[model samples]
Target: MAKSPIVFAMANPNPEIRPEQCDGLAAVMATGRSDYPNQINNVLAFPGIFRGALDAHATDITEGMKLAAAIAIAESVSDADLKPEFVVPSVFDRTIVERVAPAVAAAAIKDGVIRKR
Candidate 1:
């Protein structure tokens, strides 16, 4: 049986598969818990997203804005720094807000949903 290349067992307080269990089976793994290396926590994005919406005076968060936020988060991790075990940045990384806010705000403005630019 071939193991999965990626596994995002992002259960809340407990994940479906603990990180240790995925040692050689998965190339990448993520969980909702911060104890693991790659934690797929909303805390990494939401604050910046709200900040961007407020900054741009966006009436609503459109798909484009969401995509921009995702892109910003992805870009936050440089290609050279990107690793299978470190797909997403640490939630503690302060750069998330700096990167995501501008990207989301720009997307809102481009999408014509921003009132204040």
Candidate 2:
């Protein structure tokens, strides 16, 4: 039997939106990709990053500041190496969580979100 495909949907709950008006959400769906994409959810990112931070004894995580961290991770994969189906590196990629955590931690410091070391 073939495996069913998974599509990621980015839904925003807003009473003023359309198509599922009663649901009050605008959905931006990812038609073909992993079970989830970055825009759809942070499921791909948080766990490993947290593990790395904990391993490194981090105090906090931040908001927009983390964008730099993600960029660093994404950039580690060259644009020539990227395809729509593979924008993010696999969680199993040994360098990924290790490379990303420092940037996130630094971002937290820069954003004033980390009150401690």
Using TM-score, give the best candidate's number: 1
Model 2 agreement with the true structure over 1-117: per-residue lDDT tens digits: 123323343454421222223122322324223344333236446754676455445566555546756776677667786654455566556676667777766665565665454
For model 1, residues 1-117, the per-residue Cα lDDT tens digits are: 256678899888989888888898888988998788888999988988999999999999989989998999988998899998789999999999999998999999999997753
- Candidate of highest lDDT: 1
Poorest 10 consecutive residues by lDDT, candidate 2? 14-23
Candidates in order, TM-scores: namely 0.91, 0.51
Clashing pairs in 2: none
* Model 2 lDDT, residue 68, Cα: 57
